[model samples]
Target: MRHGPATRRGRPAVSGRIVLRLDRMMVERGRSLGWLARQVGITDANLSKIKNNHVSAIRFSTLAAICEALDCQPGDVLVYEADDGDDGTGPRP
Candidate 1:
């Protein structure tokens, strides 16, 4: 079967990286994880994972909720940092 490009470790390689700034936003907003969790209608554990960048993906609904609760834009929470090796060529090998 055909498979996607992967790294030496056999994990899929991505061109750019998304950095989560949720923890920073939370601090700036002076909101606790539990408080934000309640406002976002999500469990603290899940929110914590997002804050710690331990999650691979986040639902739009959840992102919207977080933005709403934090009173900030999505850009304020997620920042994209392009991989130095990815010069718009293709996936890294």
Candidate 2:
């Protein structure tokens, strides 16, 4: 359970968190948003939510589709960012 922001990464007392790197990968692949959405079988708007980091969850199937379309591994798309409270270690993107 979350007591407050202390256990969260919203504002103050930030901590490690998962991040999505779909935007950069898409750019490098020269793929358009609409094209990717079509390839992944998701709506452009929904994919936009994921791109902007507004969504909370994504299906493994969707992730696989994205990876296949981009020819990248999951690590190349998702990232883990650790705040100062962590062991001062951060996961590479």
Worst 10 residues of 1 by lDDT: 84-93
Quantify all predictions' global Cα lDDT against the true fold: 0.88, 0.86
TM-score, each model?
0.74, 0.74
- lDDT, candidate 1, at 25: 95
Q: What's model 1's lDDT at 35?
A: 100
lDDT of 1 by residue, 1-93 (tens): 438889998888877988788998999999999999999998999999999999999999999999999899998888876777333335556
Misplaced by over 4 Å in model 1 are: 1-13, 85-93
Total backbone clashes of candidate 2, pairs 3 or more residues apart or in separate chains = 0
